[model samples]
Target: MQWIHNYQLFLFDFDGLLVNTEEIHYLAYKTMCANRGINFNWDFETYCRIAHYKSEGLSQKIYAEFPELYAVEPSWEVLYGEKKKAIIELVSNGAVQLMPGVSSLLSALQKANIPRSVVTHSPVELVSAIRSQHSILNTIPYWITREQYSHPKPNSECYLKAIQLLAKPEDKVIGFEDTPRGLTALLGTKAKAVLVCQIEYPEIPAFIERGVIYIKSLDDLANTQL
Candidate 1:
């Protein structure tokens, strides 16, 4: 808990950490694949491997794994467009929901006047939809989305950009992430990383071995000094 007090800025990953959009995303992907006559049987275990990547990266992974499908329909742009449409429809219909403890944590941070931002690979349109549904965006000063960054998670560019924008020392920043890629990106810099185990990741020990802290939810931060 003392460690949480050492940081001046807090960074959060969007999808599974701040909001439970992973399931929605999975559904969208499944629908898109089905529309194209491709069998999308990715379990949670398989999805976790490419979950943190950008839309293009996820498309490339899918294409690599199923070349036959890709050969039949090789346009990643088309697939991504379909996925985005599905997500937008879902969000518009009030299907997406914020994660547990996110609202309280944001309120606490607001009360403490601690600077916070969301660093995510989600595109602006998707982010905008979520913002429309949640009041938390008003509390966040900066949003480092995929549109702003050339490189995504596990590349360190987004995190480094966030550090630069926050104008805080790396040691003064702490990050909350739900995926290994996001954790790796945060740890690559001087910022301490906390893994919010929203998804089923079996590689917790490896993350701890790399000096990242692991927590089950944002509610756990309530016990800290803040």
Candidate 2:
């Protein structure tokens, strides 16, 4: 079996890994659709497929295909900004909870004096809002969000920025993610990534084929001595 090194830094993805907010994001998009007189619902499978695309570009592509729904919009950016704010409010309500084993794992990491950071495709404002609302204050020593880079996830830019911010080599870092796109971003970081399978994503054989180590929960970190 493969092994995780002791005393390594961690880079985490926020949406699915740190909190169960991916569906909240989809609900926020549905709320945005209310403004346009169209009811949009994104299933788990559909959201996963589209989330692999660049963040802002993903929203634009979805919006473009439904021009009839958003015909009255003055600008795409304005619409996107509004939708993102809606999402921030949804998350700020604390309706979404942290995933199982997250707090305990993070607590253990903190007690061990491991440096940790977040590497996410989420916009900086939304990421900060969620973090602050959830009171996840001191777990991260460094944070890298999409706003810090011109390129978004599924690209290596975010992860590269985390490594630079933490001043750690790839081999000395570890990453966690639940989605294929997030995994792609983590793998692009050149760090060993632990693939935490979500209930919505049960049969991800492709992830294993990509050399990702699959775990049922973040508690696996303790077993791996991370």
Candidate 3:
């Protein structure tokens, strides 16, 4: 596809965009809360809304809804630690699965010899645990995990770092993200932002207006006019 030539360096968000860990993360959250006898009522859609968009408000909302959680664990980090335990347990049996088109897209990128890296807020432990299951993931040239960046998603600092290291003056770039929070980071960079998700989030129109593109899956690049 001609569109493949539009970018030289490619940046990707690692969780939901490259793999199906979003659902796994949600399951892990629910499991951790359930273990504490806390009822996490958010369905997948609600989880997407908060986790993908207004993540900054997540701690406040949870603390307000479940004071017991706040009393036992004051910081979300403590709760996330529990969640991490659940994630490791759940994926222990090699449960991690690639998102649709992930294999083909990654292989294609490798074949083209285009430099691509994963930029993720996930810790190296989890990213490695899940990614190690898939051999195709090893093809990624670089990985920027949570420990590598000061500011998280919705802040362009991480993506900018990837760009600074991998990009060249004459080469264009494409950054892939599946969440609004992650996509926001790419929008501020020189790379063209590509949202990779099936959800029809209300903010899609606005993101499109701002010049971000959408594809249900990377395989759609075959038909996309981009």
Candidate 4:
């Protein structure tokens, strides 16, 4: 049976959850660092954590790790902006691949006539690419990106905005996210959160206490009645 027996809408995150483009993003980040002579030798865990931010935010995060560089480098902003633009271009060219179960899961939702939308920190350019490449993009009409909100994920702005768009705030509105930051942003929106992990990450006991549900695969959700 599904987690929710009845829900008004469903919302999802694109990168890691819907598409396997996260690695491409990491590669772009590494390339950007190399071009700028920045030392970003982070392990997988560190990359996954900080990668919660998109290209622009990721650049800031990379800078924040090195205080001295961030302070003295007056040209950091312009340089980073250029790097982020390049990364976005790579993603726009259909380098990112969709995840395995996305097509089927989305098709089911569409057949059921349930309203769904995307809540992501990705910029509009990347979002457009995802939709254009995926034929099921039309299944989701309410797309809310970081630009629309003053605060992005881990802040509840995107989720709340989606709720307003769907015109529902009941517990029926379920959210699916792959990152902890996205899950944090989804908190207290009166929607159930289904975390679709790419790998087995540590469980946040605190978030579980707050009613977030963690799952290993999107296919597993198929068994859910909701």
Candidate with the greatest TM-score versus the true structure: 3
Clashing pairs in 3: none
Q: Candidate 3, residue 47: CA error in Å?
A: 0.7
lDDT of 3 by residue, 182-214 (tens): 888899998988898888889899999998888
Per residue, candidate 2 scores C-alpha lDDT tens digits across 115-191 of: 88887777777777777766654577777777788776677788878777775453487788887667787887667
> Could you give me the TM-score of model 1 versus the true structure?
0.86
Per-candidate TM vs. native? 0.86, 0.82, 0.93, 0.82
Q: Which runs of model 4 end up more than 4 angstroms from their true locations?
A: 1-5, 37-39, 53-61, 64-74, 169-171, 199-203, 223-226
Write model 4 residue lDDT over 13-49, tens digit each, in one string.
Answer: 8878988777767767677666666766886667887
Candidate of highest lDDT: 3
Model 4 residue 9 lDDT score: 84
Q: What is the lDDT of residue 207 in candidate 3?
A: 95
| Full-model lDDT, candidate 2 | 0.72
In model 2, pairs of residues that clash are none
- CA shift of 78, model 4, Å: 2.3
Q: How many residue pairs collide in each prediction?
A: 0, 0, 0, 6
